[model samples]
Target: MPFLRNAWYVAAWSSDVSQTEPLQRTLLGESIVLYRDSLGRPVALANRCPHRFAPMDGGRVRGDALECPYHGLRFDRTGRCVHNPHGDGRIPAAARVASYEVEERYGAVWIWMGEPERVAVTPLPAFDYLDPQENETSTGYLLTRANFQLSADNLLDLSHFQFLHPDTLGSNQMASGTMTFDEVGETVWSRRVCRGEQLQEFVANAYGVPPGMAVDRWLNVRWDVPGLMSIEVGVAPSGIPREFGRMSYSGHFLTPETETSTHYFFAFGLPKAMGEAARTLVEYAVDGLMTPFKEEDLPMLEAQQCALGDQDFWQARPVLLSIDGAAIRARRIMDRKIATEQLEQQARIEQCEAEQGGKTPMPELTAVPIDCSALAR
Candidate 1:
């Protein structure tokens, strides 16, 4: 999969790579070792040593360097082989291990898996209101074990919440309501209006919502790409009549853990869950509700992958209503990008062959500097 073309994927949270520990995560089938250096900056490196393939994560962070567990190979933040304990301090050009583009934003750390040279860390995603440093935010991560798109579909499929989270997070109202879509360049924002009791109360809590409100505010705007979202939810007070009120926004991120799995990151807090305190009381309740919803999703998505996995080329199933204009647009965009990337690769190979007058080995892609911050804008 050409996931690197223009997609943004989260590597780890800022809290993940503590100064005391090295975190290991696999992306696009590559194992990476991430850790904070002496200055508390996150760094990434391929989790292997060039000599005998020792797993680097087994090593410890000593001073500003990460030393390999096996051969005592030491690499700096840029993945430069700084010292070979066995061969004095001489560093060779071939001694360098592949490193990824790394950046910190919105209290999380991101590492690109594609050509590190082409990764741009400039455009990190935007959060609506819940500031990581200020709000009573809670953090959690899940390994989907399914295609990232399946998880995206799960998030985009809010209709399931009604039957899935009936007592807590579900909206009996949206059982039968309308869904709307607004396309933003390279990104899509979607909303579902489940007009009913709980939903009405939620709407009333809209920013500066009136004292006695009765309506269903747009609850979510799924950032239908691979960007993280910051959502602020305004819940109507408990005493408000069912006929009045609404829920504003709750933030989320759908990150691809692999082509087949995703990491669903979330934070819910401050006045949440009716009479009970949200940050304190609702945490467990929210987890309980989300746990089932997530579990219920596995079979459906896994089956989706199985149905299509064995093929050499991906096939598109017939589109339906919920797939909507945004999903359709996203697929089209992805297809175009994928095709362009392949064509570009082929062109490069053909050009290289022509230059050699015939059949010389084509050079691999050179890593381009990435501006990771651009996706947010």
Candidate 2:
């Protein structure tokens, strides 16, 4: 299974792609363009025109078809050129480009690069809060130099927040909480309510919680298909979930560019009663402080990814802790999925061979999703 080839990966925010036509993006290194069709369904296609090899994203949208800017060749969402200005009477049936399946959810556009026939939108992780009326949320997108896996690893761990994002969302006490992990329904949920004396002091100063009130900082990691992690964090009194202020924080990793570079999509939700004042404050803090903190993490991951080769690449465990279990389990699950996908691919090859009799040929493969073993070591 391709790490991101089959899953519903967000390409862009809804507002960014609604204007003119197909929006182009590089997920897992293949350039794809996304657009809404006549039936108002979103679809993706290989961004290049096979004829002259021009980018289809540069083309204009003419009704349902996206017209190539170079030759005025128009191809529909299925990547078929219905109208060719230079053609005699009819366009050749062979003149077409690769089209992909796309779906829009949670204010983002998702594309499928694997077998479009096998893509199922039902099992996709849906953000239910986006549908409800009581949530006040905003989406933020950023490109990072760190490996996607590093970011995934970072998000699953709440222990690093004290050092990484200390000023905004971290407390020295919560960083050393007794975390518990449980796996259910293809997802790993882990959480710990902070109780350290330092954390209690920080909470008292920040939120005016009583000195006796212990904060339950719950963090849930829903690993939707292997590498894609949906993280939710909430802070409430030791036993109460209702006092949760920041209700949700979800982050997703797009297919990597050069293995070390990644695009991160984030959806943060707070109570609507928090008002515009709170929203503006959050935005300002995230942009000014959080972004720079993320930038600080970039060099660490980049150096780690770079040191993998030419040195001892996965021959030893450098250093680890109990807190790494969340990331460890996440990797184990991904490894299993990748192995299953490889087995299925092999089975299909054998089946095709049995049909035609004799030598079996490997089918065309798209992106290489994730190499799970690398994370284990």
Candidate 3:
């Protein structure tokens, strides 16, 4: 998939993995099986069994080890095949699958898909509001039949909300709102402000504001590399301070399952409704936000993917609109990062060949940190 492998990608929600059962998921075109050990600590490993290539997740969990479904070969959390059922109980040294580094944070399980040593250096993208003890969060997952980057573009350019989610999230004011975009390092920031406009029906309902109230609305989208977006949408009385407004945060985290498939993890947060029922608040927001995504955005993106086929988005030559500024910047940032990595890999291979006196060694990829200090804000 040529993904940014050295970054942390969301594998699943924290609640999705179980101690007694295994959950299998594909990320960055690799099959990953996630399960909690006997100690209830989350673990991620390659889903394919080393011997028969059977799915490990299809098997049962024996204490902390996962048994292969086809055979009784058991693999522990470190991906070592500990128990060999047949043939004198002799386990081959090669009978081990790759184990990925995983961390449970921000209500999500993040997996590092690259060099194990580099995992600790690349910090997880922070979302302080996702803490369960202090904030109420309801997570929703969608397996979209479109490239993950397309979903990133869809969220970065919120101008589509005016048309794509007209009944729920969109408004004419949003389309005509004054927008400004800026790029710092690998992160993009976009802000849109609309003044003296009637709030959208769903927005008013979600915030418990009067329907007919004239309000000033602000939408800010912060996009980090490899597709993690945090959006702040707020509205207050016309001509009032925006800080006094009711604010809600929506997280759009995209993990590539394949070139044409994506694992979408989304969460809706309302600060005003923190004391209210979590299910009620989440259901209300999901009905308003996710409904349109399922009905409208999915079809559009899927059709676009079909039309493009195997062609890259830039190669397909999509016409740029004014609203695409932030998305375009993000695309360019990713392209640059990928290109840089490739160049470094080639350089490493050449150096290895030179040092080995004309014999080429397998290239070792060194993780380069994408400057994203501005993204966390």
Q: Using lDDT as the measure, which candidate wins?
A: 3
Clashes within 3 Å, all models in order: 41, 2, 0
CA shift at 104, candidate 1, in angstroms? 1.4
Worst 10 residues of 2 by lDDT: 368-377
Predicted candidate 3 versus true structure: per-residue lDDT over 217-262, tens digit per residue:
8999999978999988888899989889877777889999999999
Query: Candidate 1: what lDDT?
Result: 0.61
Instruction: Please give each candidate's TM-score.
Output: 0.79, 0.82, 0.91
Worst 10 residues of 3 by lDDT: 368-377
**True-structure RMSD for candidate 1:** 6.6
lDDT of 2 by residue, 1-377 (tens): 24535556667776667437668887767787877766666767888998889998888877788889899989887788888898484788778998877767666776676666567543567565443256555667777775676667776786876776565566777667788887776687666656533333433444446666556666676666645566665666666654554444555545564455677776654556778854654355345534544665666666776776433323546577888877777767766766676766666655556656666445454343322332222
Ranking of candidates on lDDT, top first:
3, 2, 1
* lDDT, model 3, position 201: 75
